[model samples]
Target: MFPLVFLTVIALDQLTKHLVRGGMALGESIPAEGFLRLVHIQNTGAAFGILDDARPWLIAVSSIALVIIIWLAISRRIGFLDNIWGRLTLGFIAGGTLGNLIDRAYYGYVTDFLKAGIWPAFNIADASMVIGMTILVFLYLRSEYPRSQ
Candidate 1:
């Protein structure tokens, strides 16, 4: 189940990136109207444009984190992946992490194309990461307060 979800998300992320790479030039912006656009950019660091030029350290840290997350998930030590919410969250995180890791490993940067006026330009991987984190937070809150007990 984990592999299936991870592969699916990774494939989707790669496919979107392929499309963007093939169709858009660097620094090109395809307006989507309002506040949305497809803008080609490469990030060599973490979320929201942090550490933008630290490729080696970023890749090493990300690789190690990915391995740890996979190990925990497979060992069932991650608790969260034991339930539906947990499984989905794990899948999203795994896929997103791997998606960006692939870019870091191969191109020394992560391809980011999706853009919004008030938000940073990011990719499908970023969206997955955000969703996974959000789910984890929700789960934590729920666990802290059991329903109708």
Candidate 2:
């Protein structure tokens, strides 16, 4: 399940980026009913365009994070890894990390699209990483301080 989820996220992320890169011009925007829109832009930094000038540093950090995520997934040392949510968390995070890392390594930037309202443009990998981290935090808190009856 972990491998499946991981690969699926990577595949979807790469596929969408590829499509956006090939089909749309850089900075192009296509309104999609309401406040949603598809955009073609490159992000050279982390979330919300932070550290836009630190490509090399961002890549190094992402690589290290990927390694640690893989290690934890394989080691299963974390008690939560025994559950489905844990597996999903690792899979999504690892997949997302690798997805962006690939872009940073190959193009020195990440291809981002899927914009909405006032939010900056982002890709599937960002979404996956956010979702995974959110779940992980919830799990950690639940395990650390179980509710008392």
Candidate 3:
């Protein structure tokens, strides 16, 4: 289950990035709707364009995350991947980390294309990470506290 979710997310991430890179020139935006667009740009840093020129740092940090994720996958500590939600959450993180890691190793940067007016440009990997993190937090909270009726 973990492998399936991880592979699916990675495949989707790679495919979307590939198509965006192939179809759009850097800094080009194709409006999809009201305030949404497909904007192609290579990001050499982390979210919100922080450390815009810090590819090395990004690579190192992501590498560490990958290692921890791998360890969790192997050890199954903290009941990691114990449930369907857990599998999906970790899958997103693993896939997102690997997606950016691949770009860092191969191109020295991650390609981001999705754009929503005021939001910074991002790709599927970023979305996956955000989604995974959200779910993880929710799961933890739900486990820790039962809702009072």
Number of the top-ranking candidate, with lDDT as the measure: 2
The alpha-carbon lDDT assigned to residue 2 of candidate 3 equals: 67
The runs of at least 3 residues in candidate 2 whose Cα sits more than 4 Å from the true structure, single-residue gaps closed, are 32-34, 145-149
Candidate 1 residue-wise lDDT, 1-149, digit = tens: 66777788899999999898889998888874668898888887789889988988888887887887687567876454577777778788889999998988888888999988889899988898889889878886667344534
Whole-model lDDT values for every prediction: 0.83, 0.91, 0.84
Task: Give TM-scores for every candidate, taking all chains together and pairing residue i with residue i.
Answer: 0.89, 0.93, 0.90
Q: Rank the candidate models, highest lDDT first.
A: 2, 3, 1
Spell out the clash pairs found in candidate 1.
80-86
**Pairs in clash, predicted candidate 3:** none
How many residue pairs collide in each prediction? 1, 0, 0
Candidate 3's TM-score reads: 0.90
- In candidate 1, how many Å is residue 63 off? 1.0
1-149: candidate 2 lDDT, tens digit per residue: 78988999999999999999999999888964558899999998889999987988999899999999999988889886658899999999999999999999999999999998888889999999999999999898787435432
Error of 2 at 115 (Å): 0.5
lDDT of 3 by residue, 69-138 (tens): 8677666675535678887788889988898888888888899988888999898889989998998888
